[model samples]
Target: MIIGCKDDVLPKPASQLRLDYPVAKYASFSNHCPIEFEINEDAVIKEDKNCEFSIHYPKMKATIYLTYKTVNNDIDNLLRDAQNLTYKLHTLKADEIIELPFINKEKRVFGTFYDVTGNAATNSLFYATDSIKHFVTGSVYFYAKPNYDSILPAESYVKNDMQHLMETIKWK
Candidate 1:
């Protein structure tokens, strides 16, 4: 064998890193707020001013912010604001924004779920309201820089959680 002979060098094919998270188990969450819903068992819910809350996911370094408001005569404004946040603010960086309308006649929960794709600030933004009495809006944010590819796993998990929360929301 010739000492100088060597195989041709080639770059290795790119591979994606696999991540796995435990199947989410949810529990009811409520306090004095006009709204009640289920939260991931792995998350910790912290109450804030004016019936607001920050649901923290320690392991994923993500937080879901929920803010409540009385709809009295401002239903239009409230709905517009939520739409602007998802469309105007995030649409700049989002590759596509999919709007999913949610309506639960029994629970009286009507709202829109915004799924923002691409490297935007947040992956999911949602607003649920009773249209006359209670209005609540929420968005999930990751602690890390907005790198969609790197956070896809965690984002998908949290997005699902947010959707569930919106679906189960009840105005109390």
Candidate 2:
């Protein structure tokens, strides 16, 4: 064998690590709270307070927080707070932020969905309101430290679920 053969010493080509998650199954989630939505069947949900919820994905080490509040003529303040929460991540570790507006005129639901890219603490942030009597905000936090590349798979999976939750949300 040749000593230090270039052929053998050449570095292997970079490759992507594959992470496979189970096909998502969703189930409707409802309670006596003023809001209702669908959640990933795999998640563990915990009620935080009156209408707030913590949707936990133990396998993915992430949690989707849902908070509900009465509009009470505080729509402006609520919107500002929600925007600030998303921008806070931008100021820190987010590489890019995309705002997608959501409107369901039939349901009278309107909101903005923030998709954060990079090693941010949260991968998604969103807020929805009926602009009269209901407001809800959601964000996903990973138990593990932010490592965008390493957590991309889990992040994508959970992000889709968050979107589904937002889409199916309805005021009770």
In lDDT terms, which candidate is top?
A: 1
**Mind giving the per-residue lDDT tens digits that candidate 2 earns over 23-130?**
999999988998889999999999998888999999888999999999888899999999998996466799999999999998888999999999888989899999
lDDT of 1 by residue, 1-172 (tens): 6577689999999998888999999999879877889999999999979898999999999999999999989899999999988888887899999999999999899999999899999999999988899999999999999999999999999999999999989878
What's model 2's lDDT at 53? 93
lDDT of 1 at 95: 95
Least well predicted 10-residue stretch by lDDT in candidate 1: 1-10
Clashing residue pairs in candidate 2, if any? none
Positional deviation of residue 95's Cα in model 2 after best superposition, in angstroms:
0.8
Give lDDT: candidate 1, residue 41. Answer: 93
State residue 40's C-alpha deviation in candidate 2, in Å: 0.7
